[model samples]
Target: MSIAETASPSLAEADRFRATLRNHPAGVVVITASVEGRPVGLTATSFTSVSLAPPLVSFYIAESSTTWPALRRAGEFGVQLLTEEQSDLADRFSRRGEDRFAAPTAWSRGPSQVPLLDGASAHLVCSRFDTRLIGDHWLVVGEVTRTLVLDDPRPPLVYHRGAFGGVSALR
Candidate 1:
């Protein structure tokens, strides 16, 4: 039988997709927001820089995420580029139904009033500009109101194949 014919279940298809993505490496980031004076954060890998002139950035969030609603209402958010030592932090943020900011983590207020994570390779404090519905996710566009390079020499944490990986050395 062909590969498609041999695939018996939808679960198998999902597994195959995930297996395919294992080869594609991605940088880790924490997307944070303040909800009713309480902070919330989640780990994300689907982030990118959109522009330079107006300093735009974009990231994707699952539509079903509870955090997104509060973040959307807040009208501002922070992006923390994780470093090699932040694998545990990434795991913490990736979990659901947990107190994300309960643990001690270094953070400082940015121009947008969002909490910019300390020890991040970089931090972007942004104002939510627009959002577009894209299938099961929301494509959130933000205007970078402030930017900071926390550690220019530090390597960022990377994720691949459902596991943490170290950043590649610069060429």
Candidate 2:
């Protein structure tokens, strides 16, 4: 049988798969972009590095995401590596039908007019490299054009078991 034929569509299997991923910790990030002179952003835990030689990074956005339509049109975007203190910020961007860029968001425009969140541990400005539909989400790859590391020393925020947390460094 083909790979698709072997896939289980049962809700139990889906729950099991989600539970497995929940046990694995993931770094949290806010993906930001500007479209038609407006800033849009969302929280994501699926952001990851794809390459090093040419500096490529990637993140997956759901196909049903309301923000995807606008983000898909942008030529450039920003990725902010959140600190442990920015869990509220993460929650803010994750919600739907709310003004994510409203006051108290504390962000500014970066190169290519991408929205850059303030107080993040690091910021990466990227130009859109490739995008393709994969399963129920869109796989977006970007080429890093600029990187900014904050001088502040703080633990990075992480997501695990449906909550936000910080990690301790092992020396």
Candidate 3:
């Protein structure tokens, strides 16, 4: 189904749905985009793989976010799947108006010409596909054009129940 065709639940229902969703562990990701050669990044835990065959993914950003507007205009963006050791980076990106890339964080260019954080569990370089206004947020769909995966073993950074957690294999 198309994003615009999807109906959103009520506010209370959405809140309850989010509460239930918190129980499902998700890998943290930092979405990056460049506006006028200036880079902006934001930490998001709502990212998900939409399709492997078509190499598609989706993430949600609050409509109130100032960052999303720039990203939406950028046309292309990068998603950096954070590792456990990158919690500090995640915290930095999550903050507003901070120099996100200030400290010594390794980065490289993605297909979007956006900075993809190094040492991440994975990276997906995508072009904007479709966006839909869903209640208080926007559901952004992207078509992955390139990807990077680390060879080193590392756990993912996870956010749950308003707290941070570490990822682990489900064995």
lDDT per residue, candidate 3, 86-123, as tens digits?
Answer: 98898889888788877676777766578988889888
lDDT values for all models: 0.85, 0.95, 0.85
- Candidate 1, TM-score vs. the true structure? 0.87
Error of 2 at 46 (Å): 0.5
What is the per-residue lDDT of model 2 for residues 31-94, given as tens digits with 9 covering 90 to 100?
Answer: 9999999999999999999999899999999999999999999999999999999999999999
Backbone clash total, candidate 2: 0
Q: Among these predicted structures, which one has the highest lDDT?
A: 2
> Global CA lDDT of candidate 3, please?
0.85
- Residue runs of model 1 more than 4 Å from their true location after superposition: 1-11, 151-153
How far off is model 1, as Cα RMSD? Answer: 3.4
lDDT of 2 at 140: 99
lDDT of model 2, residue 19? 92
For every model shown, what is its TM-score relative to the native structure? 0.87, 0.94, 0.84
Question: Who wins the TM-score comparison?
Answer: 2
For model 2, which pairs clash? none
lDDT rank, highest first? Answer: 2, 3, 1
